[model samples]
Target: MFQRRKVIGVMGSGTQAHRERVIPLARWIAEHGYDLLTGAGNGVMRTAAEAFVAVAGRTGISIGIVPGQATARGYRPRPGYPNPAIELPVFTHLPLSGKQGQELASRNHLNVLSAQALVILPGGEGTRAEAALAARYRRPAILFGAAREFRSFPEAFERLATLEEVCDWLLGVMR
Candidate 1:
């Protein structure tokens, strides 16, 4: 019987790539055969997808939750979405993000709910909202980055300073 691969969501800034931190984590996730899930815009999302797809011979693929909006011309993908690295784009009509990420209409809801686990990186309001949704939904998650970066974030998610610790947590959660 075929089994579905677990998806590991990486949430972070849509403007800052955070490459030094996201690249290795994405590679490790791909190397381990877990599908990578992201917001599919830019910054951490694009960086993570790029790294994940660059892994040679990896079975896992990059999945992006693309946000769109309804207009007089019908729904259209928001600007800068699907950032070239996404191999599997799951587009949605929910455009609200940032401060409204937790709202029902936000695509952040889909990003949080679709993944089996999550790794949160340095980000802004939208990332914070994703972190909140992760906690609210009880998904296994870890804040991976410097503590200072998430000073204003929720205290519920355990924060890890290194990728090694994050990997360990992922192994435990996945098992």
Candidate 2:
């Protein structure tokens, strides 16, 4: 029998928290048969993609929401970097430039409508924006690791603990 895929939005940054939590958690999501969603780029997005691929072995699908328009060309592996666990599905829409400026406002805007639930890891302004958007649409949001304090909506769920806690919460949602 076919099962409905649960697209879990993982909002995080391309920094330390991502190195510690976001990457591993995303891998777990895939191992458990859930699809992973994120803004396509480096840091958390890259880490999650790697982890998902690691867990899925072969049949993983990693979908990315590009800030601007995707090119007719598909994703090309950047030289000297790890290939994504699965193919990169880019949803393009330009918003900013540079490292920090690469923040994709459009991706944040569409996050809630694109997924069943959002799991926010620690991040900067961009991550906070995605979490806020999820709440604005009343989508179920669980804040894992950091970003729990910045949570400003009643619809938001916060659990600052181990990855096991995060997994338990997500599995509960699945059930």
Candidate 3:
């Protein structure tokens, strides 16, 4: 749950395009008065955090549900990937790489639980899983990117490919 600011969960890939798209969206979200929620690893997550900080003038309280233990190695947001915008990062000791899909599933569940809405960018299996979970939860999941990438996912909610459309929805419809 969010405290002072409304929390919007962003699920996107670590890919380059995902980074480009999610970052601005994150800035818009912050400018419009909302907190960012993400996986907090790399690529899209880092960019979002960075953008939010840049626009907000400081890294507001954004949640990063990391997928590992609370150690130096796990806590660090990765080299050359520092997002000063990131404030609080909640680390989960569950090893997402090892066996037991239960851990990853549980973490994803927690990620969805912490947000009121979702913004999905192009990603792989993990991103898809988060999107699917958000839909099943009946939360508004906004898909942003090119039309082809949006086509790949199941169209269960409002789908907007452009930043303007996405922002309009976030301001008018989603609000």
Tell me, by TM-score, which candidate is best.
1
lDDT of 1: 0.92
For model 3, the superposed segments whose C-alpha errors exceed 4 Å read 1-4, 17-19, 56-59, 69-84, 97-105
lDDT of 1 by residue, 1-175 (tens): 9987899999999999989889999999999999999999989999999999999999998999999987899979999888898999998999899988999999998999898899999899999999999889888888998889999888998989998999999999887
Provide the overall lDDT of each model, using Cα atoms, as 2-decimal numbers.
Answer: 0.92, 0.65, 0.69
lDDT of 3 by residue, 1-175 (tens): 8655678887777554465577778878887777788877676777887777777364346778776544765453333332455577776664352123224535676667788778888877667767767777777778877768766576796677788888877776445
Q: Tell me the TM-score of each prediction against the true structure.
A: 0.97, 0.74, 0.78
Candidate 2 clashes between residue pairs 3 or more apart in a chain or in different chains: 67-93, 68-92, 68-93, 68-94, 69-92, 69-93
Off by over 4 Å in 2: 1-3, 56-59, 69-86, 94-105, 146-155
lDDT of 3 at 111: 69
- In model 1, which regions exceed 4 Å deviation? none
The TM-score measured for candidate 2 stands at 0.74
